[model samples]
Structures are given as structure tokens and as C-alpha cells.
Target: MDLPAKTKNISVILQKPKYAGNIGAAARAAKNMGISNLVVAGSAKYDQEEIKKRSTHLAADVVEKIKYVDDIRAALDKFSYIVGTTARKGAARGPFFTPRTIAEKITAVSQNNKVALMFGPEDTGLTNDELRYCHAVVVIPSSRKFTSLNLSHAVMIMCYEILLASLPACAEIPPKLARSSELEDMYEQIKTVLTRIGFLNPQNPDYWMTHIRRLFNRTSLLARDVKIIRGICRQIQWYNNQKNT
Candidate 1:
């Protein structure tokens, strides 16, 4: 595979989420759009682990990468361009645009600046205070009667728009997940080394190992990484056994 490319950096920032499912779904949507960074700020639901499970149909490992933060400011500290998603009008900050337009803005800024797309919680769209930091706001232009959207759906719509806007002219096919045989060999090596160190506890070991396996599996570890980790574990075991003797 080619070395990781220096591509456009686009981040999704979720503020004060009340549920983990929504966060997970947001993560799925972000990853689907080729956006790898998901930042969660403010309060979050405890069941977020489940959210990642449900939202990430095939990209659960990607969902696992979502980061939690305490404030929106911290969430967007490093981005060169920031856009807020909201339905409010004539009040926030500068000029506003539709989701498509926002995506276009993202593409434009992306040529030179990393961009951050910010979304607020389900209960409320972006609070006026958060808008103070935005370069512009992208409003969905919903009915005046009820403009609210479920957090995940909101993320999905935004991601779709962004993906549509940023589709490459040549569109290089993205890389595929690592093959399973390679993953199995890596797992076996890990189990062997763990057993040697007494970490795997041969007696009734399956119970604990099963859980660890699930966690690592959820990460969709690449075969290359599994081999690297296995080698490290082998070296550690060799060094430790030598010390004991």
C-alpha cells in the first residue's frame, strides 16, 4: 500500500451530545465521507459504546477513534477553517449557506487549510456562544414550525453533502481492509506469547482472552500491525524469561 497521503483534513465536532448512539452514528457518517476526525465535546451518554457498535456497520473501528473533549473551543483549536451547522438565521455571525454550499466552502478552504465542521446536540442546534468562533454557519433551512433533526441524521446529511462536493475527478479507490488469514496468524502469535508470560492464564483463559479478542477485533487491526505487535511481544517475553533465569 502507498504511504499515508497528505490529504485534506476535515473534522466533525459534536457538542454536548446526550446519547452515544448519535455519536457513533456521527462517527460512521464521518468515516463514510472520508472524514476521519470526530470530536465529542460537552456531556455524553454512558451508552456510547453501544452507539459505536450500532452506528458503525462496517466501520466500528473507525467509530472507536472518536475523541471526547470538554469544550467546543478545544475541539476546534487547531483547524484553519471552521463551519457551524445550525438552522438559526439573521443572528449568529457572518453570512450562511446550505449544506452543499458549506461543503463547497470546505473543499475550497481544504486546498490550503484544514477545516472543521461543527454540530451541536439533539436538544438544540449550535448555541449562539459557539457560533462566535465560526467562519460561517450552514443552516439546513428547515420549516419554521420545527427545524430540529436527530443528531445522527444531521451528521449523515452533512457528510453526504460533503462527500458529494469533494468527490475527486479521478477518484482513486480507497484501500481495502486487511485480509483475514493475516489477522488470524497475528492473533495466534499474540495468544502464544501471552500464554508464555502467564498473562493469558492457561486455566480458564478463554473467558478473559475472548474479551480482549473482541476489543482488538473491533479495532479491525491491520495484518501488518498485528505482526509488528506480535514481534514486540515475542521480544518482551524473551527478555523477561532471560531475566527470570
Candidate 2:
């Protein structure tokens, strides 16, 4: 496939952005950079007037093609690589990448795999807990004195960097991996079984589950990996039923 076609493999995701204008601007930015997919995660509603005004005629198609999902995890499954963009820097953000480097890497990966570049809401960037779902974090270097970027500006810079880089050819297509939705289902099942077996404390189930999610997210589990882990959860539940009866 050609380079622009490779860019088509990227999905630009907005996570609960508060303003419709930001969503519209991000879509415009994506279109300007040859990206086609635009997904909005979480419950935030959009104002049509704002979207149209910000997108203008240039990105009208993108505005029309926008997808809405209930949450960030729900929107992530199909993509092989998930990159979270943030201005914050610290230990908990996981592996960090400069915008330029990550742009090239993501472009190369998109040759055969779906890639997602996600942005958080305007008020707060992605929560630490929300970021656990990302495989890597991309930080746009800015003056530390004033680091926070507007939602649309951040998306624009990331997309622009991607457009500047060249995607390397893949010698072989990678194996089919589990989608985000499938992993989410597996997590639910695991949580259920663990809760039933008293492995997850009722008082603070999230504390333990948060760690589990982060651990597994780093692995980028394949379809088979998900199946094997889910099978173990099923067995545990079955054994519990037998013991109770």
C-alpha cells in the first residue's frame, strides 16, 4: 500500500472532550494529515453548530463520519497500537515517546496494524487510571512553565508530526490480536471470578484491578492470550459452583 493509504490505518480518538469545537478541530486536523477515522469516547455531547463552525467545509466529511462510544476502553479494541497523548511527565505514565519518534513508530506499525492516537478531555488530561489502557504515552515537548495544551492543538501537533515522518515497510504481517472489546469482556469475567473467589477485596476492588489492568495492558495480549486467560476464569467459576453445591 502507498504512504497515504498507510495513514488511513490511523484512528484519531477524543476521550470525553467537553467542547464540540475541539472535536471538530481535531477532526479537521486528522483530515489535514490524511487520517480518516475519528472516534469520540465517553458521554460528552456535541453541539452541531460548534462542530460545523470549527470544521468549516474542509473537514465536513470527517464531522459526518465521527463515531461515538460509551467509554475509552470501548473505542480501543480494534487498534493494534494505542497511544495516549499527554503533557504531564512522571513515573506512572509508562514508556514515554517524543511526538516525532512516536509518530514514525506508529506510522510503521500502521502498515499492517491499526493504530489509535487518543486525546483526553480539556479540563483534565487522561486520568492515571484511564491511561492504563494505553500501550505507550506520547508527550509533546513544551516549555515547563506553561505545558498544558488545548485539546485541538495537541491533536494537531501529533497528527502533523505523523505526517512529517515516513512509515517503514513491514516484511510480514503480525498475528491477529484481541480487540479492545474482547479484552474488556475478559477483564469483566476475570473480575467476576476473582470477586467470587474472594481474591478481590470488596472494600477496594479498584485498587487491585487497576494494577491488573496495567500489567496486562503492557503485554498487548493477543487473541489466544485472551482466550486462555478467560478460560482460567471460567474454570475458577465452575469450581466455585461445584464447591457451593
Candidate 3:
């Protein structure tokens, strides 16, 4: 009963979760889906009793092995692709997808790199600043009047979709996708080149990079693709420098 390698690489991150019981439930959800990695961000006192009570013994391993970090950003370093779950939507959160759609996307990305599904506190979903770290947003479609779901419920739905999406019978062979570190470096180079070429304004640079990130996230850019992009950016930067000199 070993989990798929791709699914095992997927981590379920709870950002500033409030309830210990919910954390335990979330762990159960992740374990049930064959995802073992669980991370909690921000120090929030939770009732361990509730956690033990809710998770019972079936998911004791997940509850025991949960990693704690001070911030959500701290957990992103190891993940190639990050998907943040949010109940609220706005212009800032660009390109939101239903759970099913995001699950498909996650499965594709996980095939080539480590992926994370981030969940915020029960009271408030991911903040704009926190969401900035994510490559995409997964929105669980619900009634407008009551869009928010319980923390564990959200975790369950996300994990369930991902489990279904990760089934070997339905999965495609993935290309060698770029790791997060490589993508981040490429993005930085692109940003530098864009600025050098006067494509991005320094004073009020906003969604320029954000839009680019979303586009690439959807494209499932491979390692080779990232290298090509970085090469082009390097040439642009060099050309800009030559012109200035």
C-alpha cells in the first residue's frame, strides 16, 4: 500500500491553522490521499487533545510527523509548484480554478516536481502577501453566500481531487520540468532583463511578473524550456548593457 512517488512528493501545508482538531483532520485527509508530507505555518496554539481525538490512530503517523514552520514562505523552498487554496477571489489572485481543474494541474506538475497545496486559517484564507508565493490559486466552487469551507473540509476536497487526478491509469508521462529554484532564478533574470530593456517600470511595477508567472505555471514549463528562457533573458540583458555602453 505504498503511495505513488508523485503523490508522496505532494505536501499539504496549513498556514496559521487555528484548531488542533482541524490540523489532525487535515493530516488524515492528506494521508488518506496518499500524501504524507504535512506542514504547519505560524505558531498558533491548538488543542492537541482535539487533534488526537479527531485523527484517531489511523492517521497517527501523519499527526506525529507534521512539520512546523514560522511562515508559509519557509516551506516553499522545497516545493517546485505551489497551489494556494482561497475562498475569496479578487483581481489580485489572478487565474483561479475549480478544485478539479487545479487538481489536474497539480497532478501534472507533481509528475515532474514537488508540489504543495497550501491551506490558510479557518477564519481567513491566504492573505495577498502569502498568496504571492503561490504559482496558482485553487478555488472550491461553492454558493456565493457561503463560499468558505471548514479547514479540514477544504483539505479533504483538495486531497480527494488530487488523489483522483494522480491515478496511474489516467496520468500522462511528464517531461523534465524545471525545479522551483531554477524557475525562480529564471524569473529574476527575466525581471532584470525586462527592466534593462524598459519593458517594466521600476516605479510602479505590478502585475507584470505576476502575469508572467501565471502564464508559465499553466504551461508546465520543463527544465529545457526554463534554460531557453534564461538564455533569452541573458541575451537581452547583455544587449541592453551594450547599448548603454
Candidate 4:
């Protein structure tokens, strides 16, 4: 199969999945869509036989090359872009994108940045804390009565959309963005500075930082942008220290 070039930069991450079979099936889905990287994040170990059984011989390579990480955030830290999948919706959970729209966005993002398509565990989707790591969240539109989807099924739907989007001629590639690790570091600095300055509530600073995160995520910040923001934080801290002395 002549796969899309951008697809090579995309990875599918399964966070805290309970079933080995779902992991295997998700690998098969990834292979079908030309995505080679599959990461399993969490501490639980699964039976290899059960995993290989569901992946079958066709996706044996994918299972063989699966990357395991004890922490989802650590796995996500290396990627320049992350898209999370969820079924639930609330004021705090969204600004959600449809699979197709996010796929189109991913194609462009993958042109210059490593992109991760993150799916939460089957029973309970990604927690609010986990979703904070995502630059964008996608919700598969399903019947209102029962919105949840099986883990592998959700992976396949998302992978399919991404594959479809990547089939067309390439558009202008965007500038490379800062990695998640850098953005995370800057967020921590921003939180501290804001709290010290009394701009953010000291007791629950994360709640206020969620809005700040969204603002920066929408901006598609580059490496220089992160440095600029962090420099501002440092200057603020220095001035406050001088005044105290």
C-alpha cells in the first residue's frame, strides 16, 4: 500500500487501557491506516498471547514494535502536538472537534510536528487532568442515547479519518511548534508567577490555568514563543524578589 507521507509522523496512544485485546485491535486499526507507532501508557502488564491474538498476523509488526510507558504524560512530552478522544461533554471538557475536522488539522500538524492521537480507557474516558495535556479534543458524533464507543472502534474511526485527510495533495506545512514538554514547563512557570502576583487563586491555580492553556493552545505557539513567555515569567519573579528585599 502507498501510504500517506504525513501518516508516518502520527502515533496512536492508548492510555490506561484495561484489556490487552483492545490494545491489539487498536494496533491493527493503526496498521490499516498506515500509522506505524503505537504506544501503550500505564503500569498494567498484559498477556502477549491475548494481544497478538486480536492483532492477528497482519498487524504482528505493530504489536512487535509497540512502545510501553508507565506514564502517559511522559509519553506525550516528546510530541509537538496531541489530540485526545472523548465521548463525554461539559463546559470544562470541550471545545470538541469532529473526527474529520481534527483529522484535517492533524494532517497539517503532522507535516511539521509529531502528532499523537490519544484514546482513553474503555470504561472511563480521559480524566480532566489527562485532557489538559491535549491541544485539541475530538468527540465522535454518535447517537445521543449511548455516546460511548469501544476502544478499538474509536481508534479505527479516528485513524480512518486521518487516512482520508492525508490522501489529498499536501498543503502549506505550518511552522514547527514547541514540544509538549516545553509548553508544560512554561505553564508551570506561568501558574507560579500568576499565583505570586495574585492574578491566580493560590488554592486552585489549575482551574484558572485551564483557560490560559486554552488560549496558548489555540495560538499554536512555537519554540520562540515559549521562551518569550518563560522569560516574562522570570522577569516578573526577579522584580518581586527585588521589592521584597
Best by lDDT: 4
Best by TM-score: 4
List, residue by residue over 88-162, the lDDT tens digit for candidate 1: 675324467788877765665555455678898778678766775565678886667988888777777877777
Question: What is candidate 4's CA lDDT for residue 105?
Answer: 80
- For residues 198-226, what per-residue lDDT tens digits would candidate 3 score against the true structure? 89887755459877776787776778999
Between which residue pairs do clashes occur in model 4?
none
**Could you give me the TM-score of model 3 versus the true structure?**
0.87
Residue 44 local lDDT, model 3: 71
- Candidate 2, 1-245: lDDT as tens digits: 23543777789999999998888888887787778689999986789889978988889998998889998777887776788988778777767888997777676667667888999988888888777767678888998798889887888898888777754444555555567777778888888889889999977777788778778877777889999999988888999999999
The Cα local distance difference test for each model comes to 0.67, 0.81, 0.80, 0.90
The per-prediction CA RMSD against the true structure, in angstroms, equals 16.4, 2.9, 2.5, 1.1
| Residues 213-237 of candidate 4: C-alpha lDDT, one tens digit per residue | 9889888899999999999999999
The residue-level lDDT of candidate 2 at 59 comes to 93
Model 1, residue 223: distance off in Å is 41
Candidate 1: 10-residue stretch with minimal lDDT: 169-178
Q: Predicted candidate 1: what Cα RMSD to the true structure?
A: 16.4
Model 1, position 53: C-alpha lDDT score: 80
Pitting candidate 1 against candidate 4, the one with the higher TM-score is 4
Model 1 spans > 4 angstroms off:
1-8, 43-45, 168-245
